[model samples]
Target: MISTQLLFGQLLLGLINGSFYALMSLGLAVIFGMINVVNFAHGAQYMLGAFAAWLLLHYAGIGFWPALILVPALVGLIGMAIERTMLKRLYKVDHLYGLLLTFGLALIIEGGFTHVYGSSGQQYPVPAALAGGWNLGFMFLPIYRAFVVAASLMLCLGTWLVIEKTRLGAYLRAATENPALVQAFGVNVPVLMMLTYGGGVALAGLAGVLAAPIYQVNPLMGSNLVIIVFAVVVIGGLGSIMGAIVSGYVLGLCEGFAKVFYPEASNIVVFVIMAIVLLVRPSGLFGKGD
Candidate 1:
C-alpha cells in the first residue's frame, strides 16, 4: 500500500503543475475565443517572460516582485505588436494562415534563444521571502509552491470574472461573433482585437514568471510544457475558460492518483484521458456544438 505522505506529496506536486496548465491553457482559450487565432507562439511568449525576469534580475538588479508586474506588461506589448503587424492581416484569411505564422514565430523565437543561451537551463532562486516550507502532519509544503497555487488560482478566477461578468467581456464576445457588426456600432473592433491578444499573451507571461523559481529558466521550457497545455485546452474545450481551469486541476489530481496505483502509466494517463474525452465528445468536455 502507498504511504499517505507519498500520496499527498504527489497530489500537491500535481496540483502545482495544474496551476501552470490552468494559466497557460486559459491564455490560449482567451486568444482563440476572442479572435479565432491559434497563437502557437504562446510558448515562446512564455519563455520570453521567464527570460525577461532572469535578465531583469541579472543586469538591472530588479527582483521577482517588480518583474512580476513589469514582465507581463513588457511581453504583452510584444504580443500587441505582433497582432498589429501580422495577426491583424491574417484575421480575414483562413485561420491556417495565422497558425502557420505563429508556428513560424515560435520556431524563430525558440531558435534565437537557444542560439544565445546555449540550450542549458539556468536556475532561478526562489525569492527570499518565500524560500522555505511548512511541515504539515501529512506532507511538507514549500512556501513558494503554496504561493504559486494561491496566486495562480486568484489570477485565473479574476480573469474569468473580468471576461464573464464585465461589460468589456460582453463587448469582447460580441466582437468574436461578429466583428463587423460590433465595428459598425463604433466599437473599434481592431483595437479590441489587439488588446485581447495582448491580454492573452500577458497571462502566459505571468505564468512563466510564476514558474521561474520552481523550474529552470530555459529557452525550451515553454515548448516542453506547451504541448501538455494544448492538450489541457483541448480536453477542456477550445475556448472554455472555466473548462481549462477545471480540467487542469482535475487532470493533475488524476495524475497524482495514477502514480500510486499505476506508476508506469502516470505519464500517459493525461493523453489517454484526452483521447477518451475526444472520442466521447469531439468538441471537447465543455465545448458547444455549432
Candidate 2:
C-alpha cells in the first residue's frame, strides 16, 4: 500500500503542475474562442514572462511581487502589438495560415532567446515570505506550492466569472458569434479582438511568472510544456473555458498517481489519457461538438 505521505505529496506536486496547465490551457481556450486562432506562440510568450521577471530583477532591482504584476502587463502589451500588426492580417485567410504564422513566431522567439541566453536554464528564487513548508502530519506542504495552487484557482475562477457573467464578457461572446452584428451594434469588434488576444497572452505570461521560481527560467521551458498544455486543451475541448480548467487538474492528478505506481509511464500518462478521451469523445470532456 502506498503510504499516505507519498500519496499526498505526489498529489500536491500534481496540483502545482496542474495549476500551470490550467492557466496556459485557459488562455488557449480564450484565444481560440474569440479569434479562432491557434496561438502556437503562446509558449514563447510564457518564456518571455519568465525572462521579463529575470531582467527586472537583474537590471532594475525589482522583486518577485512587482514582477508578478508588471511582467504580464508588458507581455500583454507586446501581445496587443503582435495581434494588431501580424495576426490581424491573417484573419481573413485560412486558419492554417494563422497556425503557421504563430508557429513561425514561436520558432523566431525561441531562437532569438537561445542566441542571447544560450540554452541554459536560469534560477529564480522563491519569495522570502513563502519559503517555508507546513507539516500536515500526513505530508509536508511547501508554502510556495500551496500559494501557486490557491492563486491559480482564484485566477481561473475570476476569469470564468468575467467571461460568463460580466457585460464585457457578454459583448465578447456576442462578438464571437457575430462580429459583424456586434460591430453594427456600435461595438468595436476589432478592438475587442485585440483585447481578447492580449488577455489570453497575459494569462500565459502570468503562468510563466508563477513558474519561474519552481522551474528553471529557460527559453525551452515553455516549449517543453506547451505541448502538454495543448494536449490538455484538446482533452478538455478547444474553446472551452471550464473544460480547460477541469481537465488540467484531472490529468495532472492522473499523472501524479502514475508517477507513484509506475514511474516510467508518468511522462506518457497525459498523452495516453488524451488518446483515450479522443477515442471516447473527440470533442473533449467539456467541449461542445459542432
| lDDT, residue 74, model 1 | 98
Predictions: Cα RMSD each: 1.0, 0.9
Q: For this target, which candidate reaches the highest lDDT against the unseen true structure?
A: 2
Q: Each candidate's lDDT (Cα)?
A: 0.93, 0.94
Residue 207 error for model 1, in Å? 0.5
After superposing candidate 2 on the true structure, give the runs of residues whose Cα lies further than 4 Å from its correct spot: none
| Model 2 worst lDDT window (10 residues) | 281-290
**What value does the lDDT take at residue 15 in candidate 2?**
88
Question: What is the per-residue lDDT of model 1 for residues 1-290, given as tens digits with 9 covering 90 to 100?
Answer: 78999999999988999999899999999999999999899999999999999999999999999999999999999999999999999988998999999999999999999999978998888999999899999899999999999998999999999999999999999999998899899999999999999999999999999999999999999998888888999999998989999988888888888888898998888899999999999888899972
